[model samples]
Target: MWRDHLTQIIVFAVLFLGVSALGFFASRWRRTGSLDHLDEWGLGGRRFGGWITWFLLGGDIYTAYTFVAVPALLFAAGAMGFYAVPYTVIVYPLVMFALVRLWSVSYRHGLVTPADFVRTRYKSPTLALLVAITGIVATMPYIALQLVGIEAALKTMGLVGASGFGRHLPIMIAFAIIAAYTYSSGLRAPALIAFVKDGLIYLVIIVAVIYLPYKLGGWGHIFDAAQAKFEASPAPNDGILLNANNQLNYITLALGSALALFLYPHTATGILAGRDRNVIKRNMAALPAYSLVLGLIALLGYAAIAAHTTPVLKDNNTIVPALFDGVFPAWFAGVAFAAIGIGALVPAAIMSIAAANLFTRNIYVEFFARDASAARQAKVSKLTSLLVKFGALLFVVLINPQFSIDLQLIGGVIILQTLPSVGIGLYTRWFHRGALIAGWAAGMGAGLWMLYLVPNPATDHAHFGGSAIALSKLGLDTPKTLYVGFLAVALNLIVSTVLTLVLRAANVRDDGDDTSPEDYVADRSTERSSLAAVASESSGVAASRAAS
Candidate 1:
């Protein structure tokens, strides 16, 4: 057993060291003179051209959890997991509609984070804080899932053990390495590493899709094997396609997830990191290539069935890695492992940094200390990024790793609740800011409460449970099941709209205007706005020149 895993351990060591070296050296790759500014640290100088932004955003959005979980879900529960593929496909077009405008306004106004947009758009720091908190909360578990992916890979290579200290050893070291470079280089590190991460992932997936089907007697056999297994299962959800009861749930979840994807702070960070509007447009047009890869990756779950692969970890989340081990040579397996391992680091670091930027810019500077300087704010952001990474590490180590992955799904649902405040607000200022806050409160409560009601099939527990809402469980339900995320978001929009109208009727004042039509049309060349320079300048100059 130990010998079988020795090569994987060596591979991991090499790759982690390589990534760490890259992270440590990233500031030089896109170096400006001052490294202590938000532009250099937080948004990677807002200077990534088309190709870099494509790989960086691709690496950030398509994560290690995706590499691990989508196949694992397909392997365990049949076709339900294919939801990821459709969601990814639909998301780019949905984002394409708004991303250029988002970049334009953010760039023109020197917005560092999405919450900064919220603060300016609605002129309400309270609403901005709500968006920031939701983003951080939604993102923490998502980062933890990256550790879960690493854990799955380790377990497949027979590298994990139940001895408390030993099982956590690799995770602790990984976290330390990630946190070190992220603290030092900030967004630049992840932006640089993303090229390697996405390239490796595309190579691994391309090779696996071609090689695995051949070894298994072709794609037809793979599909036949998967179909037979689900046909014989007693559970109703074991098939590849949704039933009549779940059709709405599937469609709504896909759409809701698409809507929520760009609202994520990491995604916004990637969008803001682009060099110009054309880069954003070209990247959006190109991102669907990754979605195509995602579709093939999901098909690997069926390939697992054809190969008769069993789940390697204590839970069923290790299907893809297990498939890799069973079907590929040991050295190639190590490459696959490294692909997933590095993939996790790219997004986790970006998410942590994005969350930190939100806190430093919107919360700390907005409320507690209005007089904080840019250097001090950058320092605070660096420290906050460390804390965020540590918090994510806690979830992976202290909680069940399976539960952590489950929480990422819950995070998606949670993030969707912010659609009204961030996503819709990007397009229109019709919703009263106070109504937006009320809507956020109501949506968050309902989403959490409904999430609390979901029960894990394995443990039959309350929290970190399945998001599928059983129709029969609702008593009055006839024959339709619903995704908790869809229900929650629907209720969120309903409340937001109703409250907005009521406030308008009551003559409640709207917040000051922050964005104009021309502002949304401006790009990098048209506007030389620097978030760092503006942060260091007079607040009155910044505010009065824009909105205040």
Candidate 2:
């Protein structure tokens, strides 16, 4: 440990505690009614306006993992890491088209989770269960990545304890504060703290991009250094620009990631919390600005290359922290670390809330207690949120970080399988429930099989080492590799389309859709005016009143 780094630790601790206080107080922020319901606790009562929605969604998408891992990838592999930039850029317009429809349908039908939407749309609990379980499984490693980001920064600051459990104790304490405030304040905690979290992130990044390049030489020298380092490496594909071999992974990864981003339950939770469709549309149009920041952030890897800053333990993910520690003054470096630490909290809270809502609405309340009150659903969801955070904590503490990273790749593929049931179901219900389930299974199986077979240069060149699988593995006789999610999702769509045609021709009745066409497009007022009698007879009146 660098004993001289106490100043950074102190600054980090101060900002961390300050944000915890803000989170505790956020329980009272924007409160409309009792915080005893899923709508109130899990989704901020679905009442956030445009700006709150923007910060919440931004905080959820541009996470600490983005800060640490994207640059780390660029630091390690070169231009292929820049795929994150394009993925984030393309995701918003897609969001404008798809999620607004999802929001409309969810608001009209009292849906809290994507699984809730699936259950209501396809009228199949089994499919909903699959979606919920997929969400929970996919999210655990994501939350662990946040903890990994915090630990990386702490390790860089020499705040890591002497040895044993003490070494891990600092991060656990920080996450404990996050878990406590999240339990009390729920989604509102993250929504409120997002303001401070994003402010610090932007400040740190803006200062780094402007100051670091000036201090180190210039952008040209930085890129020259990065290109030289990658050129000296053994892999032919490593460089400042994508080559024939890596271009496939780069393009497919970008497209697959864009398709999968908003499909995550946390993103849905953020969007669903928006008070109206207009809020989501406006935020979607504006949120691509974060992608612009992301491109700048990814360049920090080259910045590190130019500065000659070495990663602690040669761990690539720690390079960003090490970069800050090397370049910035001690106090400001601490502030940068705080930015990343607090960045972890916002998304971690949102993700846990999302996973818990999936269980509470689609699993617990749907199965265990059909008559559960809103308060009870919220109660279960809160407790489940605690359990989910605890599970993620254990995941990072007990397991290797590389395994968690691999699972995150798998998570992308896993969540992408639900595109047919959730993303496409928004536009058309032509898909039979049976076909949708089969498509999900086919997609999941293909993705896992491909992952198990693919080897990566990063992971001792072993199978399941990364998300990219070579075309040769699939009989293409080439070195080009494709992102597993892009291929799996393609196969999923084909299976879904073919089976859909087959099932329809068989004249076999499957689980029927319960949602109407207007349900997919109506707001609260329009829903009430058009389908007032139907909504009143159903369970939607309560949601309609809350919407108003």
For lDDT, the strongest prediction is 2
lDDT of 1 by residue, 267-307 (tens): 99999989999999999888998888888888888898899
Worst 10 residues of 1 by lDDT: 398-407
Error at 421, model 2, angstroms: 0.4
Per-residue lDDT tens digits for candidate 2, residues 403-425, read: 23454666798899999999988
User: What overall lDDT goes with each candidate model?
Assistant: 0.82, 0.87
What is residue 173's positional error in candidate 1, in angstroms?
Answer: 1.7
lDDT score, candidate 1:
0.82
lDDT of 2: 0.87
Error in Å for residue 200 of model 2:
0.6
